[model samples]
Target: MSPRLVRIGLGLWFCAIVLFLLFPLVFLIPLSFNESEILSFPPTTWSLRWYRVLFLDTSWSNALWLSVKIGVLVTILSLFIGTASALAIVRHRLPGAGLLYGLSIAPLIVPSIVIALGMFMLFARLQWLESLTTLVFAHTVVAVPYVIVVVSAALRNLDETIERAARVLGADPWRTFLLVTLPALRPAILAGAMFAFFASFDDLVITLFVSGAMETLPLRIWNDLNLRLDPTVAAASCVMVAMSMIGLGIAEFARSAGLRRLRMENTDG
Candidate 1:
């Protein structure tokens, strides 16, 4: 086949894969709007009753709040820990830096179920299970690697001479980072925080293993599935999907802004 034809075929394949992936979400949107008690696709009637349940129902609302709180805490902790790790690996060239990087991202490679099981045992011994703090900590472990990867990539792309200039100007390491490095890292930091938040918010296996009594949004959805089929679950899923899309949009905007600033600086230089 000609190269142009091959390219056309690849483009069509990519579009087909994207549509296949999005099919479930497309199916769920209509189900979420269905007024009927049953979760039937192509609903006979449409209403916002399920959406009302998402807001008015105490269980769903409380679960949503808990998930948000955990997500925020996880994001903050992950950014702090991950950024420092990334800096150490990228800037300091610490001995065993490769090993550290491997360890940092190991959670992503290892099966999540294994991590959950291990965490369950550890938290049980620490008597930390069923606590919000425990959930946040567990989520932070999973989230930190994303932050590290993002910040490390951004750091690699940064102009190192600016940092050197700051140091030569008699600025302390801390001040140099605050004035030079941190500003350049803002977009990556924001992106990492969003990813971390979503990771925590969407996690179910870890939450199920560690949480004995605490209910997160995913846990609440699972409970609803077991107890009874409710259209409210669809509404909740839609809300989460919307939240994720909004977070991604904001992250993309921040990334573009950062790129524009970088371009302007390069031009000025």
Candidate 2:
């Protein structure tokens, strides 16, 4: 094909791909605002009824709140475990390092249902069922692998020479790590934390098996959908989508800024 023709084809392909991905979301955003009892294409009389229902219902509010709390906790927990484990795996030479890495990433590869079943049985044995503690623990276990992957990538790009220089200048290993290494890893850590938050917050399968009375948003949404599909659920979904988009926007903004900074640095050098 001629270069001009190839460029035209690629442009059309990219636009088609973008529309395919985004069209559903465009429909959904408007459909969520429908005042009608039923969700349908080209919804009638868009209003805030569903949104009002979401805010007014104590059960929904409480579940959403619980999910948020759990998500934040899981993110923090994942960052701690994942970032630490990533450093251990990537930076240190240890016997059976490959085995350790495999173990660390095992939860990600294992199906959620399988992990849920294992957790359910283990928690039942320990009498930890129905507890937020157990739910958070399980979520953290699953979410941490994301943190490990993100932070490890970030750590790799960070020049190790900074840490070495700090150590040579009479800084102890712990001090050098705290002041130098940790600072360099911040953006990646934030990215990992965001990933962990979303994973735990949006989780349904694992939460369903492990949790009982303490209902998270995903569990409540699942239960609601099972009984009867409601427009309110669509509203809630819109809210979740908005939340995710906010996070996505932040990540993209960070990436853009980082790239610009890198370009500036390269130009200066």
Candidate 3:
């Protein structure tokens, strides 16, 4: 095909894909407004009863708190382990780095069901079910590789000479890293942590395996969806999606700001 026609075709394809992906989200918003006793379309009245009911339910509030706590803990653990591993691989040039990196990334490629089964077995054997600590640890294992990949990319893009220069100026290794390296890695770290939070918050398989009595949002949603879905679920989904979108927006903004600063500094130099 001609280049011009190819461009037009690609544009049309992109638009079609975007619409297809967004259609369900668009449909759900209005559906959440339905006031019917059953979750049927074309409701006789539009009301806020579902939303009111959602807020009035203590179970949901507790679940939200639980999920938030897990997400934060998972993000922190992921950042610590992932950043350390990334720094070692990228900066220290550790032996078997490729193997280490691959192992770290294994969770992403492996079937989640398999991962869940393994976790469930481990928890059952250890009698650690319903422990948020185990849930955090398991999620951290899955979430860390993303942080590693992102932070390693940032480290790779950054020039090593800056840290070397700091060392030459008599700054200790710790000081050099703290002053020069960490600042440059901040944006990628922030992005990765945000992503980790979302991944853990939204995870169902692993959480379901480890969570016996503890109910995260996704588990709760899954159970409710399997039984009877109310417009409250839809409303809750809308709120969660909105929060995710906002977090994504902030991450993108931070990334752009970091890149812009880098470019300006390079231009000045």
**TM-score leader:** 1
Query: What's the TM for model 1?
Result: 0.93
* Tens-digit lDDT string for candidate 2 (116-144): 99999999899999987898999998999
lDDT for every model? 0.92, 0.84, 0.85
Off by over 4 Å in 1: 1-11, 256-269
- What lDDT tens digits, residue by residue, belong to model 3 across residues 56-125? 7887767778888999999999998999999999888899998998898888899888998998998899
Best of the two (2, 3) by lDDT: 3
> By lDDT, highest first, what's the ranking?
1, 3, 2
Give me the runs in candidate 2 sitting further than 4 Å from their true place.
255-268
RMSD of each: 2.0, 2.2, 2.1
Task: Write the candidate numbers in order of decreasing TM-score.
Answer: 1, 3, 2
lDDT for residue 227 in candidate 2, whole number 0-100 = 85
List clash counts for every candidate, in order.
0, 0, 0
Q: Model 3 TM-score?
A: 0.92
Q: Mind giving the per-residue lDDT tens digits that candidate 1 earns over 1-269?
A: 99999999999999999999899898789999998999887898989999999988999999999999999999999999999999999999999999989999999899999999999999999999988889999999999999999899888879999999999999899999999999899999998889889989999999999988999999999999999979999999999999999998887787788778777877955
